[model samples]
Target: MAYGEALALQRDLAQRRIDRSLDHDLLLLVEHPPVVTLGRGSHAEHLVAPKEFLAAKGVELFEVERGGDVTCHGPGQLVGYPIYDLTQHRRDLHWFLRALEECLIAALRDFGVAGERRDGYTGVWTGGRKIASIGIHVKQWVTWHGFALNVMTDLSLFDLIVPCGIPDVAMTSIQKELGERSPRDLWGRALDAVVLAFCEVFRQQAQMVELEAVRSGA
Candidate 1:
């Protein structure tokens, strides 16, 4: 889905959750076209590339309300937007963020990747290079705008911005680490791993709800 479309869906779901109309938490996994997003604390100078250059490369830019610095999203990146009610579990935001990092770390471990969390940072990293970026927002104790894991992403695109406002840090991907591996296959497996990890970490029963069922209020 497009980033805008996903954002709109998140808003709708968050509102439904706030109204107590949605009973189950949702994890939305999607791949977006090349785009750059600036979070609430993002500095404009972090965007190293010019607007014309970004436009020429078909990269869209949006200043978002999520908490973080500027970050890029594109094909081969697995973006997970978890619309969850913290009231059902723990209401502590710091614990929730750490849980998310742990969830990603566990998922990476399934693929033989050692993902770790850096001190004073909010992402999963390996060998000093970040593998995932996390930025979230909570409304009425419900969270949205979760994590972005670099699967087969083109790492060069990250050069356009000081990712998460961190300088001298590198962005790495699964494909980069596992050369000659099939990105399509790895992406599928990663999704499964993440879903399972999320369920286990949050203590929720996993259900595969069809989009049609969700739209129809079934």
Candidate 2:
């Protein structure tokens, strides 16, 4: 699905939480998209392209209500959607962001890429190029939208926007940074890192439940 649709689903999930209609414990999905998105509070000037140019390239540009500036998402990337009930955990955005960062940091470490959160920055970076981006929408203390780590994304699309409003911020991917295509079991290792990071950050054991469990009512 498109990033916009995914955002819409997040909004719906948030509303469900607010109304106390959501069921199940929590759910998460790892996916990849084919376009880029910029948050609503972000400046349009950060987008260096003319609308027609993006349209010609079959790239959809959208301004979303999430926090942070702009970032790209495309095939081969790993986008995480954690449909979590923050109320059940902690309702602190700082903690949530930190947990997400820890996930990327651990995931990258598995691939021998050091991912760190630069001071005053929100995403995970390696060397100087940003390898993962985090921006989310929270409603009534529940979070839906999450982070995207560049497993093997096409970095060219990021040139269309000054990512996170930072000038000359380099973008990199795992394939380029590691100088190797994803190993056959690369995703499994990344998933393990994600779950491990979540466990470490939240200080609680987590069970991987099916997406249908969340959709049934949550």
Candidate 3:
């Protein structure tokens, strides 16, 4: 889905959750066309490319309400937007963020990828190169705009911005770390692993429901 459409869906679902119309937490996985997003705290200088350059390259730019700085999303990147009600769990935001990092770390381990957490950072990293970027917004204690894991993404696109507001930092991916493996070949397994990890980390039962069913509130 495009970023705008996904953002709209997240808002709708988050409101439904707040109103008690939605009964379960949702984990939405999607691939976006090339786009760069600036968070609430992001600075304009973080965007290395000019507006015309971005336009010529067909990359959309958006300033969103999520936490963190500038980051890029594009094809081959696995973006997970988790609309979760924190009222059921602990109401602490820091705990929730760490739990998310742990969830991704556990999932990466399933693929034989060693995902690590930097002492003072908010994302999962490996060998000093970040493997995932996390930026979220919580409304009424319900969360949205979750993590983006680099799968088979074009790392060059990241050159357009100072990712996560960190300069001179490198971004790594599953494909880049493990050559001769296509992300498509492991996409299903990765998704399954992430869902299982999320369930275990959050202690929630994950039910696979179609988007149409959710939309219709079935």
Candidate 4:
């Protein structure tokens, strides 16, 4: 999906949920083309590449409302946008962030990766390298712009910016961790693990629905 369209979809879903027109929580998943996003907490200096450099590399950049520093998304990454209502769950952002980490960690365990959290960090890491980055924006307690898990993403993309605004922070992917043992459908497998873990952690029976269904208020 394009970053701009995804952002619009999230806003639409979030507004529907906030207005009580949407009856269920949603976790919309996608893999975006190469694009850099700046969150509300992003610093100008965090982006290393200039406009010409990124344009030449075919990477699009945008500013978003998510709560984090700058981050990039591309093919081979799993981006999950959970349009969840916090009122039905815990209303605390701290708890919500931790719960997101817990789900990612549990999902990583399925792939034999021991994911952990660093103090004062809001993501799941493994072997001192970040495997996933999480940033969200909640309006009226309805969340949008969720986590991005590196499944088989090119690590070189992180070079274009200071990932999560941390200097020299290493980003690792599932393909890098599993190497030759990784399945050909590595992205699909990772998505399955994440959905299972999300169901367990959020205590919701989530099933994948068509984009049209979601768009038409189904």
Residue 84 Cα positional deviation in candidate 4, in Å, after optimal superposition: 0.5
lDDT score of model 4? 0.94
Runs in model 4 with CA error above 4 Å?
none
TM-score per candidate = 0.96, 0.88, 0.96, 0.98
List the pairs of residues colliding in candidate 1.
Answer: none
Residue lDDT tens for model 1, 10-59: 88888888898888889888899999999999988899999999999899
Which pairs clash in the backbone of model 2? none
Best by TM-score: 4
Q: Tens digits of per-residue lDDT for model 3 on 1-218?
A: 88998888999999999999997889998889999999997998999999899999999989899999999999989999999999989999999999999999999888889999988779999888999999999999999999999988899999999999998989998788777654557777778888999999998888898878866776
| Cα lDDT of model 2 by residue, 103-140, tens digit | 78987887888888899889999998888888887877
Q: Clash number for every model? A: 0, 0, 0, 0
For candidate 4, what is the total of clashing residue pairs?
0
Q: For residues 1-218, what per-residue lDDT tens digits would candidate 4 score against the true structure?
A: 99999999999999999999998899998999999999999999999999799999899999999999999999999999999999999899999999999999999999898999999989989999999999999988999999999999999999999999999899999999999989888888999999999999998897789999998999
| Per-residue lDDT of 121 in model 4 | 86
Best by lDDT: 4
True-vs-predicted CA distance for residue 196, candidate 2, Å: 3.0
